[model samples]
Target: MTCLPLLASASGAAIPLALIIPFVLLLMLIAVMPLMVAKVKHWWEHRYPFVAIGLGLLVVVYYLLRIPGGGETIAHTLEEYFSFICLIGALFTVAGGIHIKVKGSATPVGNIVFLAVGAVLANFIGTTGASMVLIRPWLRMNKIRLGAYHVIFFIFIVSNAGGALTPIGDPPLFLGYLRGVPFFWLIEHVFLIWLLVIGLILAVFFAIDFRAFKKTPSAVQSEIGESDTWRFEGGLNLLFLLVIIGAVFLPAKFFLREIVMLAAAAGSYFSTPRAVHAQNEFNFGPIREVAFLFAGIFMTMMPALGYLEQHGQEFGFKKPAQYYFAAGSLSSVLDNAPTYVNFLELAETTVRAEEPAAFAALGDEKHAAVRLLLERRPLLVIAVSLGAVFFGAMTYIGNGPNFMVKSIAESSGVRMPTFFGYILKYSLPFLLPILALVGWLFL
Candidate 1:
């Protein structure tokens, strides 16, 4: 439950490759099962918990019965699992308490404005928070012109890239913050990278959405009637959200942060009315699914991540861009926060060796290791941070919010793409090219 070393041993050797299969199978189940079977899709969706737990337990049993350090590995993964679920569940609950209603036509410009606002709000409220608050409004606004592209772009902007500015914005950055990286350090170093990625993606969205808007028939009317006004209900949850952020910002222990977040969620839940939740169409399905699936992922990925922490330098992660692609490629399937932590440890090793005095001055105190690493390689930090946040859009499970957004959109009758379809058809074609360009220009 405490801080963990990135590598299984400081000596640098890979773990057994077999340790990764359960993780791979889980991803395959997530990506392939829905497409391969039509009627069973709903069953697969609801029954993912069994599939995850069964496979996860296989790895646990292997470690518990067969390996020496397995107990420590399981413990670390469990700590991360609890923190991940707590933060995600709390944010989901609190955001669900607030509902926004829009009464007007769903114009392309208006839609762009709405998304742009969300992109900015993501920096403050966390991507998951902003997405939960804004997505329903976005869906309802563009109900007439709905397409898969809308949700896809939503994942790219509000759920990922927009969260680059602050630690609270995304899980990876928050992990970085908890490791002693300064709060403003993230915003300062990544400001241009954020500007470039967010600006370019927003422009691309406007172009695509404008074309779609032009082709749509003019008879589509606003669902909320013709008047143009906006109203917000359950505004007290905003105060609860601020309390959650305050807890995160304080120099509290990890468990304390979890407690604060859960308390905020509890406050929101008990304070808000049933009508508000009904208006938000909020329920526990998305959060529950995320918790179950990620519990398995966090458990299965332990040895693999531990191995990477030790031997990552052997894989030629000597340059900033190398770390970017390496961490990001894995992050596209694995949980990005753990992936970020693994790379952070890997990068820390190289930095500590290179700048012993700088790191020594920072001291070997509790969070000092990460603080020293953060100061050592600004470019490497930038790459790791950007990679974790940006490439997370590659899959539904890449980041926590991706699947939650998909679930919400689906419940609202937005036919989201199947997992593989999402990657091959949309992500590979659209996002990959942009990622390549960003790599060329920035990383």
Candidate 2:
């Protein structure tokens, strides 16, 4: 979920430890339920929406009845949730209307090239948009030799890290833009690190894919060697995609942005031919699951966020590396967008407290604190931005696009890793080291 300005006003005494239980339990259930016995898994699949909502309601009720200024917090959170789901649902709907068909099997080299292209495209259309549009074609191209690594690496590159260069690329960066950072500031600062991280991840992906490629039978290799052909359908949806992306810049008043996105989605949905929809196998199931689950996530995490905001400085984070790892660690479980915002606010608070005279010298200009922070402590911003974006790949629920990509892949018959399996198999072994290296070198 994206951050709201109201989050900054969640000022009060610290939240009780017990109040955080629903959030912890929800996360545990999300992680463990899919790995359980078939009966339990089946039960979870059917009942998760109810469970998520029920738990979320517990926290909501507690906040409304017990806490001061709780209603405003919930209202702002629901607002963020609505905007979040609108963008996600619109992208899912619009992208589903456009179908890409790859006629030849994918070679390791070809797959790497395709992923590289996706990384660049993510900066323009956003991770969610790029992931939604490219995932089906990616799956189709590698169907013969597809493995969990394929989807996992796709999540690492295209769905998360690839979207670091621009505000439109990811929700956290976009919120950063809305908060006062310049639109092109991220690319200006993080371009090299972005290239380095993307290059290294691609290299790792290539080595693994090549080994798997060698294991394919000669007949399949020969088929893969065939000339690749591409077909594009529902070209009109490109305009709708642009509309959704453009809507991000709209003022978030009277639901204008969400309305624009919903309108585009509707226009794309009704105007597209049935054959394209059938070919894409587009349905509302993935988006539906995401909406229900995140509704709970956004609500339940309110107290956790409030707790962090109130006492974050006590954690003794005073360096860029600390912010990087701390923010990344939290982003691994919490939604990265809000995680980014919280860490950003933390950085601001730290600077103001540490250097009151310097902060005061900046006067009361709009976003003067952010400007001063940029001038004096640029690396903190860089670290938080990188951490939030990169570590979002650590879990399915870390970022909006991660779960959607997993759901899409699974619906296409790809046997994905469970929540813990994803971390153990991919995030811990492959992604964490690269991120740590980046933090060590750059932050």
Candidate 3:
């Protein structure tokens, strides 16, 4: 089996191990980051948007020499990569300009129930769709529902899990479908994990929400004149998201269409500049952090992927179950689309080997594969899908939507935890255990 370009043409294949070693060096460099991050000069700024961009440039430039397909395909993927961050950042920042932070009044228990139900609703509206629609409302609800952890829970479940079963709901699942995983495969296999995560999170949410609700007495009886304090100042960024969605809906496999759409979006943003004293004032720092780190991961992991494809079978990774857990674990931290691609390559390699016997039977050019255990396909699909959506809740920066919610929360005077702070205080303590349960019970 040969290596295929996800963004480029399939012209280049079979990348050598010798070619991938430099990236291994780069990974080693980052592996000791906990030691390096402290030694930096201006830690905060360098830690954020700049760090992401700098790392991205470093990795891409390093790998550009080794990886083939140096034409429009490489150019296209590069454009798509940076453009995704920029556009998403621009829209996020601009959105902050329009809406004022309004508070809500609800018990933590009720808040948890509301969000648990909200995740289910997100599926029909679309995860990204729901993120756009409900984020502000959730923020408003939290305005009055003071000291509630429901926002994070909302991000973990409604913002992420709610989209696990459908490609339309999450970008990663869409990538899987594009790579030949069936659209309905997620629902058939992955929904159980989604439900488990949701159920557990909701249960936790109920405990915390209820506890908080009890501590804070209702202000309903007081002379609070302004009941509807939540105001909605419409921003043009929402319209831009709709356009991006429209552009994405087209089978514009490459960045040509996305580029054109992005160009139009850029034009619209420049033309309709928001007031200086915008609501939250969107920052690129967070998205910058994600872009740079993932770019390094994306480029360097190309080699790791090459090795996996050729040798996954040697390591007794022949079943769909193995692929499921493997892809899921990587997708938990690594960006999900590329993780899906890596596994797809492995699947192709394994299937191609059976071609001789299969060819002897059906004699098809695109050789058929013997299905693994009946549980293999479903289990694999579910693991990847569930991990992509659910584990994102494990960290604030794990998913795009998670940061968006955090930023919105912080702007509204809610002191959301810092990076490691968030993990130690919230994610590592609470979420990991449930995630482990899901891994055991399902994956």
- Give the top-scoring candidate (lDDT): 2
lDDT by residue (tens digit), candidate 2, 1-443: 23333243445545886887888788777756766899999999999999999999998998888887778778878887888778778877888888887765588888989999999988877788789888988988898889999999999999999999998788788767766787788899999999999999999999999999999998888876365578999999999989988888788889999999999999999999999999877789778887887788778878776665566578788899999998899888867876787788788767766777988887756566567778888898999999999999999878877877887889889999878899999999999999999999998
Measured over all alpha carbons after superposition, the RMSD of each candidate to the real structure, in angstroms, is 3.4, 3.4, 5.5
- lDDT computed for candidate 3: 0.56
lDDT of 3 by residue, 1-443 (tens): 11224322233455566645644554444333423455552464355445444554553564466446634344544544554444344444334334543445455554666676668765543554466456666766655554526667777777777777766566566555544455566677667677877888788878887666566555641322245455656556557656654554455355554575556556544654454223345444554555666565555555555565556566656655566657656555545556665666566556545454543464432212213211234455555566666666666545657766776777678877666777687777788788777777765
Q: What TM-score goes with each of the models?
A: 0.86, 0.86, 0.71
Question: How high is the lDDT of residue 419 in model 3?
Answer: 67
Where model 1 places Cα greater than 4 Å from the true spot, the runs are: 6-17, 34-47, 50-77, 215-228, 353-363, 410-425
Off by over 4 Å in 3: 1-44, 47-103, 113-140, 143-145, 168-171, 177-196, 218-226, 235-240, 253-256, 267-277, 283-296, 319-325, 331-338, 353-378, 400-429, 436-443
- Local distance difference test, per candidate? 0.78, 0.84, 0.56
Q: What C-alpha root-mean-square deviation, in Å, does candidate 2 show against the real structure? A: 3.4
Q: Which has the better lDDT: candidate 1, or candidate 2?
A: 2
Question: Ten residues in a row with the worst lDDT in model 1?
Answer: 5-14
Error of 2 at 384 (Å): 2.5
Give the range of the ten consecutive residues with the poorest summed lDDT in model 3: 365-374
Pairs with backbone N, CA or C atoms under 3 Å apart (clashes), candidate 2:
none
